[model samples]
Target: MSSASLKTIQSHSTRTTPMPRYTMLAVLPCLLFASVVPAQADEHTQPMLKRLAGVWEVEEGMNQGEEIPEKELEGTIMKIEKNMIVTYDREQREVYRALFTLDETKKPVHIDMTTEMKGMPPMKSFGIIKMEEGDEFEICYALPGADRPKEFKSPKGSKVMLFEAERED
Candidate 1:
């Protein structure tokens, strides 16, 4: 995605009743990354995509160097299926919908997600993903209009969001 597209996504007005901070920070990246697993994934990516297709619960996350308290992440859920990702808040209300593409050829697995939140313009984001042992995985992504993050850290001054999730299904 081009920088201009990212800028357009970031330029939209904020919602009047904003989503909870943790909901937005912790679940958005996962939603975006998970949405990209196409059903027709190539041979090289099929195994990884198969592993990612399921229901997940956010276990922990950090955004722009601030930790997302566990209390805030409670009840957040992400469901992934064949290139589509849907995210729900604690109340079980859908908060985001996105489509994603994955490039497993990259060392850490590159992902590009295009998300459309209610009443907002679609936003495109880039990030890296790592699948860990036994149904655990992590994703680190940049905010709309920011450069893709090179590492998994979301340190101070970085526009990155990092999340670790575990399969719930």
Candidate 2:
């Protein structure tokens, strides 16, 4: 198998490349080493995660048929303190926080979100997620008024827009 397919951490925008999963798994350790070192004394892991700590612009793609102007960030570094991986995006006063963690296999990350509004109900949601390579990933939010979670895709799928560090920059 190739590392491309298995590597859950997304990298540059895929160029129609049939990125093999096993390829990514093989490539990850090296890239992870270059990027993720867990030793507190090691200055990489926290910073790399921090690189994930920022705002991102969603370029609506094939799956997402609409566009929105603004979005922001919400979450804590302690989010990763335990086994949970929490995150969010903000727009003006409204905030959306997503809490999740790598699955038992630690490949496709599982995520959940809470949309906060002043006079409306908070939308609680979940998604089977992976890092949107190159600062982009999608999620299918579980709508409060709905039964099954609907399918969503795009740079911002459903209401779950994971703001990541833009790779181009």
Candidate 3:
């Protein structure tokens, strides 16, 4: 082979050579780093999310300054999964289902809710949640296109819903 041709072949062979040692060295640090990294606060650390997992009864509810009677919420069940929340009606028919994310980094804890109902596009709602004195917990969320609520109080005429719930444990 010519000198130039030999050099070209050598370069091609090097390029095709397996990088076993280098690959292992590069991946070792990543494995170690992943093992040592602590988990960030997710739904697991968000007490409200954990406490909200089980069945819940709407103790009190207010929508647009109108008080929602308990009977209206009777047999209503709120179920929280890892990253989803579901609500069922008296007949155990699902009324609403939402995927949510929690940011404990925010004071009062920020909650983003996305509800997908049948035949409708998903709706977004910004909310905050906090535990009350006892087993009671309150959540206030703004309707789609509305800004995050500053407080649990829903202003009149605004698409806001403020409600307190008790775990049905």
Candidate 4:
């Protein structure tokens, strides 16, 4: 073709049209939202969370090899909803709430719980959990700032606590 026509074609081919600012603004939020939504949805859909979600009554508990008194255990309840765990006392008063994460790939299912209490700094505890038959489960965890427990036991002066719970009907 003519040189002028060829140059015009080349220039047009090399040109890049800028996306409109308003379109980018709108698309950026959607992109951010899309990126976030899947992670949140995936967290809720985790198989472990599905199995753990429910109300549970604390059947037995031990701390530092000392058993918690039966009276203290009475009327205590735990509720796992999504990734949150809420515990209530004998009077049904909220005791503490924690956000938890599970690593099911680990042999004994690793758990990390972060609790925030009013007037206190956030505390993170590491633990291992075992799901048993007949809707019973056990958890053994170290206190905040301590190493994760290697087993489901709270030996004397171990700074670990173990709890056995049964799912409520």
Candidate 5:
């Protein structure tokens, strides 16, 4: 074979062989970046939960289009812990315990709460939570057997509950 022809063939082979390494180099950074993005988002939301670690009282609540009287809620206290929320009744009896997860990547932020009652079966509820201007926060959640709420507002529905709470401590 002529020297020029041999050199041309060698160059063509070299060009095709390096494609795999080039592709691997391109993909490595994306893989690394993908892994870190979720972790950083989780870390950012950790602080948001921390801010909720305190005592709160519900200023307003609606269940199935009926307004819950303030007197009925006055006895209820919501305590938010690291990964759990506990509700106490007027008699200081533990009424509810739920483990919750937050997804801040959503536009309005999404929440999943798994509640385990004393005599009832475990229930999972989907909700959207938002922090207001002050130390108040709101939650509009779908009851069991319902779908996730798209907006923070709950209309006249039988399976939706909305609570407006303020941090007492």
Candidate 6:
């Protein structure tokens, strides 16, 4: 073969050859990470929340074409301290925990917490809850930043909880 022809053929073969196995191995992890994501939902659970001495409840929702029958989840809170709280429910599969601070009005300000369902968007909301007479409570600025604050009532009494929703505006 002519020297130039041989050089051209060599260049074509080099360009078409498979990459080294080590290079492929190094790229596999990156490919997996591109397709895989770590999921964090229940930042905490019901039994986890029961540490706070209070009341708790859960309301059920319905699916498409289904009716939401009246169902209540009875829960209780066992107070751990002035700044810490936990709640547990009747079924006890769920628990919630909260670390609290204070607002200017001295209202309880939630610093951050795990009183939310799994599969929700990662979030932290600051708000206060005040209890009134009867089975009533108020979430001021509660679920404020969140599009919807999931609600739950305390079984021991009425420490109504409104959790941040999994949504980004």
Tens digit per residue, CA lDDT, model 1, 115-168: 968788999989998887777889899988999889899998788999899999
For model 3, how does the per-residue alpha-carbon lDDT over 14-132 read when each residue is reduced to its tens digit? Answer: 75864576899999999999998887754445566675677777778889778888899888778777889888888999988889998877988889999878898999999998877
Candidate 6's residue-wise lDDT over 27-135, tens digit each?
9999998777545443233222222334433333222223334443323333345565454555655455555544434434223443444565544545454443433
Relative to the true structure, candidate 4 reaches a TM of: 0.71
Ranking by TM-score: 4, 1, 5, 3, 2, 6
lDDT of 6: 0.42
Residue 69 in model 6: lDDT: 45
Give the candidate number with the greatest lDDT: 4
Worst 10 residues of 5 by lDDT: 38-47
Residue 125 local lDDT, model 6 = 47
- lDDT of each prediction vs. the true structure? 0.85, 0.42, 0.83, 0.88, 0.82, 0.42
Question: What is the C-alpha lDDT profile of model 2 across 1-169, one tens digit per residue?
Answer: 5777645444554555656879989998899797766546633333334433444433332323344333312221212323233333333332334333333243344445455455767666555443454455444434444332334443434433322223223
Q: So what's the TM-score on candidate 6?
A: 0.33
Looking at candidate 2, what is the lDDT of residue 161?
A: 30
Q: Which pairs clash in the backbone of model 5?
A: none
TM-score per prediction, in order, is 0.71, 0.37, 0.69, 0.71, 0.69, 0.33
Candidate 1 C-alpha error for residue 115, in Å: 0.8
Give the TM-score comparing model 2 with the true structure, all chains together. 0.37
- Worst lDDT run of 10 residues, candidate 3, spans 40-49
Of the two candidates 1 and 5, the one with more favorable lDDT, higher being better, is: 1
Summarize candidate 4's per-residue lDDT along 48-124 as a digit string, tens digits. Answer: 77889999999999988899998989999999998999999989998888999999999799999999677778899
Provide the clashing-pair count of each candidate structure.
1, 18, 0, 0, 0, 32
Clashes of 3: 0
Candidate 6 at 111: error in angstroms?
6.8
Please give the TM-score that candidate 1 achieves against the real structure.
Answer: 0.71
Pairs that collide, model 4: none
